[model samples]
Target: MDEQGVRGSGSPPTGRFRRGAAWWRSGPPWVSRWGAEGGRDGGAAWPWPSTLLLTVFVLVGSSFAAHGQEGERAALDPFARVLLLVAAGLLLWRRRHPVAVLFGTSAAAATYLGAGYPYGPVFLTVAVACFSAVVAGHRRAAWAAVGALWAAHVLVAHWLYRWLPPTGDAAVSWGQEAVVLAWVVAIMAVAELARARREQWARDRAERAQAARRRADEERLRIARELHDVLAHSISVINVQAGVGLALLDSDPEQARTALTTIKAASKEALGEVRQVLDNLRAPGEAPRAPAPGLDRLPELVTQAAGAGLTVEVEGEPPRLPPGTDLAAFRIVQEALTNVVRHSGSRHARVRLDKAAGTAGDPRGAALRLCVDDDGPATGADAGGSGNGLAGMRERAAALGGTIEAGPRPDGGFRVLAVLPLDGATAKEGER
Candidate 1:
């Protein structure tokens, strides 16, 4: 019965050492289920020495009890002795079969008492089996076994001693029995509480893991959006230049050469930025790359736009800006120039950057202003009404605690104006 219970409880089929090897070779069932196979090497093997010590103590204690009482020893029948031994043997598999051990040992102890044998070893066996049941996650079984043993003790003692007159001294024995029962129930209650705590901890750990996964998915989506918005415009420019080069290769050699060069430069820059983003995705442990296209790169950006046949002029010097502010400034300029080439149908464009003392006590300490004016016809034609380019530029500036205004100027041209805070040190530090 104990063997059957051990099998039913899903314990390892092999010896403790072999089970430890299996647990190490392929991680425990819980870890494997979560796809964390092959964790640490091996946990501590089962403590065989403790089992050996318990066995030795039980055998020696029973032998000593049998030797000390002559009449009790003689009255013990062979069947009773065998039952006691079976009860003791059941202890070997107690951890894997607590319910079966409790039942079998309780029944065997009852039989031993019925056969008129000494009750010392039988009582000891019941105590050990009850404790084992409580420790092995079988609180309900432990309570039931305690009740059955208490009932059997009362019935057997009453039946054996009923012929004698009652001395009215039942209070002490009843008190001892009550104390023992209370102790066993209290121990089982403590174990149950501990099990509940462990379950709560497991639930908390699972919730934290789920939240982390959700956060990672959100971050990935955000990164994808940024990549699309930043790189798509450059890719579109490259595509247009490549198409022009292909069409003019046979009819206009010099124009085709210029277009090819522009395409090559645009493609190279796009590949570099894309590679940086990909690297960040693949190896998150590495430090991040430099900030993407800050204000410092504005000169090269303007030169590239000019090479693409749009005349660009820069005026005025601005105060140093925060990293995010600089990035926003660069992107606004890039998008504005791209719009000029793609939609404005303008031959000349001017970019102005200026810094001035704060007015109206805005709390930014200093104000940085940017203006882009294009000498193009104000008529809504050639992707003029799309508004995507202007919206993107405005979003970039607004993200840096700035505002933008874009519309047709009264002088028959288009204009974009933005005002951003220069003293954003507190905001930048807070982000870090």
Candidate 2:
């Protein structure tokens, strides 16, 4: 009845097309409750060619059956042709009003047979309606309508024929009814198989949609963390230098000029990094204008901290690293230092890097340890930070099969410690 197939691909209609589609999908409440089945267009209009063809076939075929039956049944007349027309025409609404069509077609068929019209392809209309209703999930209605029709036909053929049209006819045998029952069962069985397949396709589509949404959400979170690490550290440095410049604008003009230059450099660097991040967002597959910052840029961090009135010391040489691990490592250190400048009163901090188990003769990948510490009593400013920074740090580390620990030190200030695998393969092997 609704052979248009499964729902359309996921790109939804838009503008007037979308509105018109919504209107099509809407229908009478009873149809929804009956669980009518159709294409995405909601069985909006009649299937004219198919319905007309069926009506023509049944009319011609019934005429031949009537001629052969002669006196055994009533002759085909205007009333008999009207019954055929009614049964076939009901199929036009089979997809949108399945249950109604099922009963309507069966009723017309039953009345025609009760009046003693010869048996013919007029039963085809009833079979089509029954198939549509069963596939549309109106199983009980489809079964009842066909079942009641068969029972009524049995009563008419065996006993009631004496009181009905074409009097003096003998009762028909039971073997014919058994054949009719077999046809009914076969039709319902095929409809059930189709319904199961449709439901499975719907389930698969839902799971795929859910997985796609999950991936999109994770990408957005990663980009947000990237933007935060880039802007927060540079902005803090600019804020500190601006304060120093303002304090000595007239009293110490030369020192003030130096502070102004530091702010300019910090702002320019921040802008360049922000633009780079945006470039990746806008044209993801294109090569970057510049490489990502890594341990090689550690000196720049030291110089920026100096402008912010803090002294930072480096303790170990940077290790050879994978590109992903290198970018994650740089962001972790940057976030840790930003926390130190904003939350700790101490003017000094230390950074240490170590290849925990690597050596010239070792063939296996090694873990890299990073530590940032400051001597502090809390400054209490917190710089209005949103508190996502430390959580972001932990998430980045965990993503690469690494760990991070950040808290106040037992002896004096705060510390951020991280240990990361050299590469993804090493991380997975370690996990195993």
Candidate 3:
């Protein structure tokens, strides 16, 4: 087959085989797309290359052995040369049809020996075929083929020597059989080792692919959470201000203008934050280290809530927290107040921040606490939420080894309480 035909597709082998030795490794054009057999590891056109080298080695080595063993064995004739070629040629299909190729190589080698051709590198063809078969996940078939060849050799060398060529040849000694047995055992041992190594490499590659997929999934989830927090809180305020603006557009033009002004500010801030998040996605390494929203931005959220007509009460003081805990705290507060504005009948909500007393067996700076509350008969029975806001809040808290408790209070209101861990989360972030 020509180079293009054997390659199946591509510019042709270029680096090592620039001199066009491809024909030495390939057969007829009809079988060029060898890897399409659906059970091999190499490309569609590149079967085993070593098969050609083995052919050359066997032909040359057998010629030298023939002269040395001329007195004791059948001369290397044209027929013997044909057998050598047949054995080596069968190995070309070993990758795609390992079992079949092994069977063919073994039969040809056994026939060559049984015909009393001088033994030299003839057995090497069978050994190469068996090694390829075993490494291709066909160990049982390889062993069977090798065992069949050994059995045929025993039959010829011991009982059928008289009928074989080189008449008057005596039965081979038991020591020669022992040597053949050892040789066969060694071939199987090396092949088995190679098979194990291939399996291990495949497993390692699969594990690395799985790990890459897992990291991508995590990054996607984090970006979604950031977008949800930025949009939901900002959009909720815009929704409130737009409603106020429309209600007072005719009778109270100044109030309407004030509400529209708030809408513009809220939208501008939302777009800026959204752009920051997306810029990090598009060029994460080069994006500026703009500070992420944290409790430091808590007062800005309160100002936005006031414009939306939800009067927010503040208590206690925000702490200097680890970046993870700070961001989770900020998002949790923003989402809670957003829920109050969107779902509750009450226009008043309270937010409190405190350095929490750690849970049992934990250090003092181990947690920060946030609480948001609104007196409410909600707009509906399911006024809780129908979106990712609450779920995103819980995910953020849980990721930092923290907890969020958002439920109805006994005194007829909704309350969201979050306790975020400090020390462990900081350590984990540093490790990352």
Candidate 4:
């Protein structure tokens, strides 16, 4: 599932990093997704914020290099200024062409050093390029840039030491070379860390969004089952009673009055149950609640079905059940009887409950078995096989780590049998 939105951090990044982060996040969606792809050498690759930062680094380093040179000798020539500008400008496309950027920047920096220009951190541009390339997942190009630039440095140093005299306390030393190497390594490490952190954050966010979607789906299913049960059973009974009232209105006034009263009672009951289901949506602390139906309500259910002209027979002692199991049992029976009233041509149905002996690997030691059957047609819509009712029963039973079998029996009727564990071990499994 896609994340609906991102929650901002309570404590966000600060200082220069914060500013950069803001700019980075402000870009269009595609920019962020494309950031780690092939840079300058491929498509439109200038992630503007990063390019801007690189420009600033390059300009500052160039100025320092020029000033240091002038202090030691003379100001930078126009050619050196132009070369530095060109190198910095090329970094604008670094993301799309990282390898090329690394190579071009390394060449410019090397040329500036070789020609005896001011050496005041101008090499920082090449270091930044190498870091960008590595973090963009181009390891070979980054390492190659590092090795080539270091080689250029060695050659430039050798040339200067061999011919040019050391200038006014500015001679390069072994310690300075080690420090520069360390700076390159440090930049690489920081870039790698940033990339890892970013990827991990994206993964965590995706997982949270997926979990939220799954929870929403489950809640919808539960509400759907509630609505179906409350409406199907009660509305069905009321519908039947209303028809009887109309049939008796012309011949028997007292019988018609009784039919109307039955309708009134059924409607009121349905409205109450519907209200209860809706209240489930309220805030947990504010919503008044009631216990869900269980086997104890079976008698009332039978009476309701009888009023609808369906004869329902109940048998066997109701087994002790966990809340989830009990509610599921009641729903299974309720849905089955509703099917009988709506689809089964026959007016009679049987409901059976029994204790199922524990078998091997049965953790509950016993299970509660529920079976509802009707002497309806063996096939067609009247058979009760083609409806959401059976599917809901199966889902409920499966949620409790049990199973339901529903189909037309060989003896010319439809049957729905479910076995649910009563020990509560699997009751919570559905939530998970």
Candidate 5:
């Protein structure tokens, strides 16, 4: 085959050859045509065999051609013809064991050259072997082998004809060889870069998916904490009232009726709160319900604690708060007082809410502070160590852009202090 036919043949079908063929075909029309044909016919699988067969056919045809010039011979010698046949046989195993095929073909070509074979057909076989190596993902090995073969070619050619130096016409030939080698290297590099980029994209997509899942889990946990804190406190109060009613049934009918009334009221309120929470979960698209207990409900909350047999006191005017901050402030005080009733072993507790001008001197915002103190014994224990109660309180405050500190007070009590942002764009304008 002519050089144009050889170069135009592009790559082959299947494996790495298909990738190379697709890349090469993305060029001019001639390359595309050859690539389409070669890729469809698996030309890359046994390229050397196909090339050698074509060479033999051409040589035979050339022998029959009219040649008026004197001392004109065929394009290949007898030994060279035999070597090409051997190289063709080796091509069958190229894909399975490209390294072995490359070495075998290289040795045969060198021997054919040593025996004075015509150089053209032998060079084509060497190029096909090198191409096979590249398609097998062994570009470095192919380059190394080609370099060794070129060095050997220079030495052998010089020994055969001593007057020929390594430069001049030979140097020009080497330059052309270097260009071909560079082209092959570029192809391999491009493939490597494409593969690397694909892997990076996959990794980034996986990380984003993981982040989404984590956020969903956190939201679910927050909802669960809300349900537990609200329901547990209401149930505890109902349980206390019911016990009181049972104890007074025979001794004092009037007191028993009052206790029963308190139980019914607490139960109804607890049921309403629970239904509202469930509705929020089921219909997130629905309009939000009226805001839960905030500063306005502080007095009612304090009254309930007093009814539960704890002396409760309130101090300071709390700032108007954003909806979320308001809910968080109420939850903090509610949880602190609940702990006092359940575990403090104390009779009196104090709640103080304050709003003041910012220490940073910003006109647009103010600080809302809450402090709940109980004259309970030093129950020096980790909040998390006991139950989810205090942890739920902390999470509530933190979610509303606030900070909470809870521990035993130095003066024989437990104190919880939460500072929340108020007077922001979200807060009512006239109230700050």
Candidate 6:
């Protein structure tokens, strides 16, 4: 049968060959893609250059083995030469069908030896096939190939010792058998080790990819929070003042001028804050260092809101906090106040800050409480908001081990209350 048709026509479709074929193909999907050309890890193409080199090695070795043998015992006819060519050709399919190719080449080489041809590294084809199967994660097929070769060795020795003259290393001694076994075992060992290393590399690459995705998610959330804080409060104030200026332009020129000035100041502050947010996008080492806004800025925040026509009352002292907690607290208050200005209709709003030492004698625990409340008959401006403000505040507070409660108060206003843990937050930030 021709080489291309041999697999289907010359062999039984059941038993060891069938089992081996199934096992070899059942490996990780990537094994099939491992060709000698064009793929990710290694190409799955026929490694022609290497196969040609190995063919030359075996043929040259065969010639050398024949050189010293006496008589017509070592002479090769056209048929014997074709057998060697067939054996080498089968090796070209090694990467794609390692188990099948190994068996085919080994059978051809065994035929050559059994026919009294001079021995060389004719078994080199079998060794190559065995190694390829193992590296492709086909342990069963590789070991099966080795076992079949050993069986072939025994048959070849029994057949040749009786009729043919002993050529180079052809004696059927136990030492020769031992040496053959040792060589096959060594090649299998090396192939198994290579398979292990490749699998480990794949796993490590997957872990690194997952880690990068997680970091990207965290960075996206941080940027969203910054944009919300920078734009929400400032834009709300500016919107209100702009409306006031337009309303008073002719009737009350002096109040209109003051309203326009407030609009200008709010816009300037918004611009500066947005610039800081943009600067933070720079490479870590190049980013400017600035103290993050915290509760200490509440007084300024109140003044800004008052100018926007909201009457804000501030009470109690805000406790010292870790940077993360401080930022969370500031944003919670800012969002609450912004919502009041934009959504709540009442002019009067109240903000309160207080510290709570956790359950009596709880040496390791304390928290800061923040509350913002305003009477509501929310205007149509609230409808234009995307409704992400309160959700963003909740996410920020949760990140620092805090909780936020926000809903309409029974007395006819909306209220936001956040409690942020302080005990371990600062220590954790310091460690980081």
Q: For all candidates, what are the clash counts?
A: 0, 0, 0, 8, 0, 8
lDDT of each: 0.65, 0.80, 0.81, 0.73, 0.63, 0.75
What's the lDDT of the predicted structure labeled candidate 6?
0.75
Where does the lowest 10-residue lDDT sum fall in candidate 5?
A: 1-10
Global Cα RMSD, each model:
13.3, 10.2, 10.4, 9.4, 16.6, 14.0
Better of 2 and 5 by lDDT: 2
Winning model by TM-score = 3
Off by over 4 Å in 5: 1-176, 290-292, 361-365, 378-386, 423-432
Residue range with the least summed lDDT across 10 consecutive positions in model 6: 1-10
Runs of candidate 6 with Cα error greater than 4 angstroms are 1-101, 112-125, 158-179, 358-364, 377-381, 426-432
Instruction: Check candidate 6 and list the clashing pairs.
Output: 34-44, 35-43, 35-44, 35-45, 36-43, 36-44, 36-45, 37-43
TM-score of each predicted structure versus truth: 0.55, 0.78, 0.88, 0.74, 0.58, 0.76
Estimate the overall C-alpha local distance difference test score of candidate 3.
0.81
lDDT of 2 by residue, 30-136 (tens): 34432223434545444556777899999999999988999888999899999999999888788778999999999999999999899999899998898888878
In candidate 5 the C-alpha lDDT for residue 262 amounts to 77
Off by over 4 Å in 3: 1-28, 32-45, 359-365, 381-386, 430-432
Query: Candidate 6's residue-wise lDDT over 216-322, tens digit each?
Result: 89778888877887788898898888889899999999999999898889889888877777787875557456678888898888999999889899889877777
Q: Give one digit per residue, the lDDT tens place, for model 5 in 1-432.
A: 111111123122433333344432332344444443343334443343455465675345433431321132223546546777776566654655667777777777776555444444455555566666666667677667667666666556555433332122222256665765675466446645654665678889999999888878876877777777677667766766777789989999898898888778778878888888888889978975855767778887777776667788999876666677777788778777777766666779998978866766665357688998887673333222236776777777666556787776666667788877675535332232
Where does candidate 2 have its weakest 10-residue lDDT segment? 1-10
What lDDT is reached at residue 86 by model 2? 95
Task: Give candidate 6's error at residue 66 in angstroms.
Answer: 5.6
